[model samples]
Target: MDKHGNSYDKALDVFEKLLDEPLQKVLSGPLPLARAVGLATTSGYRAAAIAESEGLLSRSTEGDYLRGPSTRTIGLSALGFGEFALVAEPVLIQLRQATRLTAFLAVAGNSQCMIGPHSRGRGLTFAVPQAQYYLPSLPVLDDERLAEISLSNRHEAVAAQRAAIAAVSEREDRQCIVGVLLPGLHEAATDDLRAHLRKASDLLRTQSEKLT
Candidate 1:
């Protein structure tokens, strides 16, 4: 059984693998179905056929596999139909406008962060769109400590290419990390940026509480 108490099913595992492989190499272009069916068993090929027929996977003209219509529909629905996204979107936009930097909300857990809704900044920005980041240096948060983290200088050393300042707020049993991505912010403006980020995070918490 998994953490959700669902029994493991091999067929579902193979199906998920097929979807994940192409997405992992999305920038590199389509992946061959055979390659996606890593360690191809009889069941693997069967799963691929069903996924293609159900519009979860599509084949390129040259016969390589990429995500299909169903994936797009699901992604769109996730962004459009969520109360969390709706509440965060306006706050993110405000944060971006105030700081001239990309602002985002991510679900923080399991030593990794999965970025969700975000507002993009103008000109050049170091925004990590639809990306998952693993930070070994970040310790698991206890309820009391889920307030904020000043990750500007520390994250500069950890990520090397990006710096972020974020705050964690729990609302309706969900822990959301709201932050801003700094492209090339001046050292003097760090304090102002942190203030804006905190205000945005507080707005999210207040709005989310109203929904409950």
Candidate 2:
């Protein structure tokens, strides 16, 4: 038995092995035997009780177990992105998970902008103070190097002017302008990033049209 009352090593091993299998397969197939062996060897029951307390798992009315809805929601939102469908909170969580990095959702505020909410990856900590000031300018990147330059000098007046031009040039259906800042990136990666952002924006537009 280990600190969490389960054979920590065994539980981790089982968890890692089962990860490649679908949850339904693990729940309905012989994987439970592995779990049982792990449990018997350690404090599996105690660990399960603790997990239940933490809302990580739950028993169903039919006596089957399943992950909680919160977990499912996060999973679904990870690869899904649409502006209209993007609830700030869940999408932010999904972004952090998918990118394995910190992320933010900023919106225009009173003569400035604000980072509404953000999420950080597992074991990562972000120390940006709350209500950090955001400039009311957007960035346009004609190339990857420009993107890097815009982000590195986000507060500079010239960079802000360039961003504003880029945002306007890239605008489609609506005039909603926003800039994305990525850290430690090089110019070579700009093409892929631009393609992804364009797709994301399109998805958001589609969702918005459906709503109205």
Off by over 4 Å in 2: 1-86, 109-111, 121-130, 141-181, 184-190
Task: Give the Cα error of residue 76 in candidate 2, in Å.
Answer: 22
Residue-level lDDT of model 2, residues 110-207, one tens digit each, is 33443333554454323232333444444334552123223223355543211111121122322332233343333232454454444433443455
69-106 per-residue lDDT for model 1 (tens digits) = 67644653453324454466578889889877778777
Give the best candidate by TM-score.
1
lDDT of 1 at 141: 46
- Model 1 residue 21 lDDT score: 84
lDDT of 2: 0.40
What number of clashing residue pairs does each candidate have, in the order they appear?
Answer: 0, 5
lDDT of each: 0.59, 0.40
